[model samples]
Target: MRRRAADYRRPARRRLSCWIWGLLVIFSVAGFALFVLHHNQHQEDHVEQTALETNTKNERVVHKHLNFTEEILSVRSYARQLAEQMTLAKAYVIIAKEHNNFHLAWELSSKIRSCQSLLSKAAKKNEPVSLDDAGPIIRSLSSLIFKAQDAYYDIATTMITMKSHIQALEKLANVATVQSTVFGQLAAESVPKNLQCIYIKLTAIWLEKNSLRELADERRNSLQLVDNNLYHFCLFSDNLLAVSVVVNSTVSNADHPKQLVFHIVTNGVKYGAMQAWFLGNDFKGATLEVQNIEDFSWLNASYSPVLKQINDEDLQRSYFERTKDMSLEPKLRNPKYVSLLNHLRFYIPEIYPLLEKVVFLDDDVVVQKDLTPLFSLDLHGNVNGAVETCLESFHRFYKYLNFSNPIISTKFDPQACGWAFGLNVFDLIAWRKENVTALYHYWQEQNADGSLWKLGTLPPGFLAFYGLTEPLDRRWHVLGLGYDLNIDNHLIETAAVIHFNGNMKPWLKLGIGRLVCSTSNSHYPEKLSTTLPQIINGSMVIDAKGPRRSLKVRRKMSSLKYAIKGNQFKIRHDIVVSIQRKSKREM
Candidate 1:
């Protein structure tokens, strides 16, 4: 009975205790969480609000950034309108006076007065008002108005009055804009509106341009990125397949078993050379040739680092044998480039003389691979000349010149001209002969006249003269100028000859070396740095001895013929010839 009585209050007390403790813990946790969340939210809201306010202020300032341009344009328009109104008012007054309607004349005079007042007010208000400080314009306008008024009032009932009015206007104003001259300047055309239309057009054009750029950016950032990421995930890298250089070659002499080929390129201005070098590694049997002493000088001076190989007698023999029967006597006998012609012309009379085909290279490219297959590919005699650019449609050139086939019977008209690039395989023997010598002379004259045909212009002329219509594959020789790796997707995919066409050569002294660079890096001494392309950076060097020799050769008959001008080396063959002749005569 006693235990039962005690249990009744104990159970109730236990239940109450459990309930209170549970409630207390719940409330404590909830309060802590609420305090933290409230503080964090408040901080975040304040930061967000401050950011938004700052962004809004910046946007407002940026929006008003164009105010200067807008004001200038506005002032011009307003001033022009006022001028037109003043002119119309004067015309109306003149008509009224001619009609002898005093009422109409008086009415129009009032309008004229009103317009003048409006102009004066506008000019004045624009001065100190809101946008611009046109104080000078206001003063000029006031003075011009006075002068114009004298002219305007001088129009009396007779012709004499009109003449006097015109004279008065002439004496008062120089540009007919004496009124409100301080308002906006159109006199010196120094005003933004007059001189900077290009800037306005630029803004408008770039808006459209930027639209395209924006679209491109979006695609690049979104779709292109996704595609690239997906592609990278799927595959490793091996995008490049291969590269090659093709050199067209001729059969060696009947007695010689080897065939000879040449690589033509641009050097010191190796803008073309560097690209050709790196990319041309794919070509096989392609070798660079500097040829005679003068060419070697340019190769040494301009591209000093170019390593000279020991003479390959066997290679020379093969080249000689291949060119033996080739018909190029005319080019040799009457060369347009006298120095180059003379050096090769001495043996024009020799029958079965070796006339190897060598590529004249400008040091401005890089080779990626060996390039033998391309040069050696048998075109099945499709070439009109040694090298043919059948990809060019003669119509594109002729149509622009308005040279219809019907007009000029001559098929060789420049208007009808085809490709004129430098990568060519011509019959040197035939060129040496007088038959084709006149063509080189003509080209020389054309160049002297200032219209220097680019690398692509010569082959067409040569073939046209020879009446060669050769249709070949288009990938043999490719243009190498301005190959932007970012924009042109196809640049890395193919391999052919890339011509570096620009004012600056990649290997030249001032060149950035990205477009093209030199191949003679290890061959040239540091002191010989100012060779070829660097010639422009240094003073002229006319050694007229041996081209910057590492070791001086004794005064042999050919010793004094290094073509150095003053501080730079001479690469032109003509310079070498003069030295050689002088040295030989002295000996």
Candidate 2:
């Protein structure tokens, strides 16, 4: 039994041992599999962590770029606003000086300083502004701030000088009851004797001309017809000869010459002369009506604020005396106030209320091509369509404006383009809606206390039309033809309108002669030299021993005859060709 029990126990034990071995193998396999699984899970977890870290770094870089872009945009907007404010502040400074308001100027200066400080602080942030990105703007604003400060100091100085002058005048008033008449006489004697003679002669001529004023009203009622098909041209001129040229040019260049109607406005003295010239000339296709400036009901000294501002005795005296400082041609100077005819264009809106649009031409301009195309041009809702002048070598805005005043420098771009006023297309409806006339009045009032501009109606036009100007084709208006001796003949030929902007008019003695810059041998007529003023008489006769160059010859030649004599060039018919020889000293 023990042996049998032992065998049974042994088999059971064997079975149990086998079961235990199998269980152990299963446990080992399970353990290995679990270990492999755990290793794979750990690798995945490490990859996910790495990916998260990379994503976070990328996001930070993207945020930085976005922040930088936003900051740059903010800086640009701030800079533009600051520039505008600076310009206004500069104007206020001038105003303060004019009104003797030092407190306002001081307050403005302090505000400007504060703005500078804040702007500097905002610009100096680390990692906030990129030097490469914002460097240009930052530098410009910084420079502008410095310039504005300097302008403030200049204003202060001007104010001080003005105050001194006022005090001196007050002292003089107290000191001179007895000596006043003698002092006045002495001052009168200080004027150049030649200048005094010329002034007196000119005044006499004007007085004599005025004595012959015609009571006959111009034939304006006949010209204004119900038909809307006629092409209208408006002009304000005192020169009958110039008017004849303009009318002839216009009539010849038009496709429908008979359909043209010229609305001519002149002073009381010139109305009769203008009508006589027009009638005698016989423009077969064109019709013109001459009206005196006094005929315009809305036009008076009280109508425009600009007129009121400049109508003062002191202002008129200053303007008349400004010729010396302005370096104007002595012959062009007038002892009286600036011509009221110059200010007439400002009333274009009221002058032609029934007309929708019109092109305003300066008397100095000569029309070349057909101007009917001007009527067809799209103004893009602008009140004025004109050629930009800033592209020219000399006719920049800075050439016209006083940039030393912060107001001028800050408010306007020194490089901001300016337009020529000689040929302008005005949209009357747009002008009325924009209230441009009112804007013109406001600026004129600002300039009332102190002279804001040096000369001309164009500056006021620039301010009034500011953003409302549309840039026309440059070929439409070619400028500086009178003063720019070096202008290309091809440009003149191609231009729609040729403008003689300076003192040397084509009608002047030397004007047409100087058109051609180079010549070999030019013969000038002796009579042409006589046409020149006394001031220029001696200079016109060239020294033949040195070089046979320019001799003021005033002989009338119907056609130019060119003949070459060896190295010498001869121009027949009194056409004076002045050649400027290169000096040996210069070489």
Candidate 3:
């Protein structure tokens, strides 16, 4: 009986073991299935994300291509219109000559000459000509056609000849359209005649013996130049009036004018004029120092990529001269890429070795508010404090760098934000610790062939200061006053500084009318008007006692005086006040 019972218990135990083994097998299979499912889902998610990014990139390329195509089409249309008007004008000129109408011929010839002048400007500037520009010739040609018909001047034959001319021009227009596009892309910036005239007159004044002798006087506040407790500003520029405006505006808006110090560094060619302007003018109680960049014996080809490029004759020709290849990039031809002054901002640490921090201002900027508060802003261990330009996404690293290069692709992010250079608060202590200049040198050496980047100092700035820049509020610096037209007026009014960072400088005739007023409203040195008068017909007459009087001479003098005192035709409020006081006294 005992043996039978033990056999029964053993069989029961075997059944229990079988049940446990089956349960373990079922749970293991379930866990493996769940793991496989999750792995597949993660891979799908990654592929989807990659596809989305690729599509976005393709869309941006397509949009850019569309914009380029539209520009070409508009240019072609304008060319055809201009060609038609020119042909019509030529036919009218022939009819007038044949009829021996001297006055009519002269009038038509004058209109033709004016059209030719406009064509010359359009060709040289690489700017598009509008139908409205040919309005005068169109009207003259229409009136002449009526007169020719009345006089039986073989109008039909003239029309036939004009048709052939128009047809020939149409063919040439196609070639011109392509050339115009290329020229437009590679247009080089040059000093305007008015600015060149100003510079010449200022230099003449600078050379005069005993003229602006006050500039040679030593300042008692010279010790404040490198004072870390004070608000220090550095300006790197060649334009005298621009520097004056910058200094004047800064001084005018400062909370403690005596606490401000400006260190200006310009090229050797403009040092005399720059020094003379600042010396002749007063900026409340602010300290000003002007130094020549050429005096810096250390800043040579061995230290600067731009200096090396300038020393290369092949690079100079490629940058300044027109090339026939349409494939050449536009930025490669920009002359500013070779200018040492444009790249001087990178060497601020070396320029002022003693300053712990600085607020660097571009010559094209105007200060509207006190900037002393900028010094107190915490940088959180960053080297640069700048206004980020990446709100539009066009200013990201991908836009400025050659991402196709393996070095750039592997080391940096394409979508990282970019910052502006025109207005920056640099922490010199942090900058030195990070050796930012050495980093800039390394990248610049890597891009010695101009492959890693295309143009401007901002690209290298982006690389050297990556992850080391703290973004400031946009209100600190408002940009696009030079090129963008649709910026909000409220934003401009509230901004601490307004920057004209593009081709249209406020001092140039090409500057936007409204934006120029905003710049002109800022204070400039009073001596600027007296020292450098307005230029008329490419000549400047510097008469300290004002011009002599005839009825016509007085009229010209009145306009010129208005221009000089009013700061380029925009009358200042202070000038208006003086006029009001004079009227009261006369009454």
Ranking by lDDT: 3, 2, 1
lDDT over C-alpha atoms for residue 76 of model 1: 37
Please give, for residues 83-117, the per-residue lDDT of candidate 2 as tens digits: 44555565555556666777767766766665555
The per-residue C-alpha lDDT of model 1 at residue 399 equals: 31
The TM-score between candidate 3 and the true structure equals: 0.62
Error of 2 at 464 (Å): 0.8
| lDDT of each residue in 428-484, candidate 1, tens digit only | 344454344344344434443223332223432443244432333444444434333
lDDT against the true structure, per candidate, is 0.34, 0.59, 0.70
Q: Which ten residues in a row have the lowest lDDT in candidate 3?
A: 57-66
| TM values, all candidates | 0.30, 0.50, 0.62
| The candidate that achieves the highest TM-score relative to the unseen native structure | 3
Cα RMSD to native, each candidate?
31.9, 24.8, 28.5
Runs in model 1 deviating more than 4 A are 1-352, 355-369, 382-408, 413-417, 427-460, 463-466, 469-472, 480-489, 509-587
